[model samples]
Target: MKKISLYHTEIENKDGISGHVRSLTDDAFNQLTSSPLKSVPGTNPEQLLGAALATCLNATLEAEEKRRNLPHQAIVRVAVDMGRDYQGFQFWLRVQVKLPQVDQQEAQEILAICEQRCPVAKLLAKSQNVKIELVNEFGFKEEFK
Candidate 1:
């Protein structure tokens, strides 16, 4: 088997990590995020979770669209709600994925893929490594990528 690597690029300005995202295929991408730390300008972890789910759903949808030759673009809109818990802030995401000409059974199947394959959804569900790192208004912070 051949090892494949996909490349994507982003730049940070006054507003955190925001730039173009690309892959082996697809020309669908826009401004990535805004630092929620107010000082940092990029989105926080919770927003990242939502973005992760959306990314995975979009990726999966792209593959399916190509396979089925569907007309019009299939969109996967994901919304993540945040709240406090015993551990920390917990995110409740509602993935209202919309696609054309898909039945309930098919919708369920796509959702299953998003739920299982979306890295953030799986990570949140698995509860393997859940932690929060606090930083100052504009202080340096680091973690495992």
Candidate 2:
């Protein structure tokens, strides 16, 4: 198999669970990161991962909507739960998608395609803890204990 690079970027985090994370490819991409266990004034890995999944999946959904000549009204929401497992700390992700412009069956089809196409979703597909759902409304439950 041949591999071709469509895009590449590097991100660096120098201070572990606290401090700053910045992208080497883009100077404007920088953010303060902190531990989720702390009440610090910064974003944590859980939020960041959720944001990435939501953004990437929504963008892929938007592309599919555009191809179908429908209004771009798809919404993607990701909820990440971090907890202790037998091995130590583990994370579970639940992604919900809403496509208001289409019927439930069509929405499910679109979501299926998006799941296969979305980069972030594909990356997380290997994990049994990751879930992708097609919903008419958003109602995320609390999973952390």
Candidate 3:
């Protein structure tokens, strides 16, 4: 099954739809405005993408705790690092997991699995591209596709 669906919508009104997006799922909670700098405060498009990957890392680690069943002495923390450039953006999510009772091999395997399987991490590591489409709503003649 597909885990994510790419959503795109256009609005010309004041502030547009940037402020209207909310958590459609409990798993993915953080969202930010991607409009021009004049309209949004303290943010740009890259920051939002960083938040998405970080959120995924946290959620995946928490879920791994249950899946691994490491007794009562388990703790997990993930450090997400994001680097951006005009050329491209990349993420290096370092998952520092501590499990008291679990063996070293088991812990390593769990961390590796979580890091590789996390959806946002996968997207970022795979170098997903943003596809933009420009449409002219004011059609003088035929429709613009």
* Candidate 3 Cα outliers beyond 4 Å, as residue runs: 1-40, 71-103, 127-145
Candidate achieving higher lDDT, 1 or 3: 1
For model 2, the run of ten residues with the poorest summed lDDT: 136-145
The C-alpha TM-scores of every prediction are 0.51, 0.95, 0.43
Q: Candidate 1 residues 1-145, lDDT tens each? A: 9966576555333433553323324445334554353564445656767677677767866676667676535566555555668998665555556665676676557556656665555666655333222111222222221
Q: What's the residue-level lDDT of 111 in candidate 2?
A: 92
* Better TM-score candidate (1, 2): 2
Clashing pairs in 3: none
- Higher-ranked by lDDT: 1 or 2: 2
lDDT string, candidate 3, 1-145, tens digits: 8766586434222344365344544435444455443655544444555466546665776677777664444443333344567888554443344555566777667657776887765665544432111112211222221
Writing each residue's lDDT as its tens digit, candidate 2 over 61-88 gives 9999999999999999888999998999
Rank the candidate models, highest TM-score first: 2, 1, 3
Scored against the true structure, residue 7 in model 3 reaches a CA lDDT of 68
Q: What is the lDDT of candidate 1?
A: 0.54
Q: Rank the candidates by lDDT, best first.
A: 2, 1, 3
lDDT of each: 0.54, 0.93, 0.50
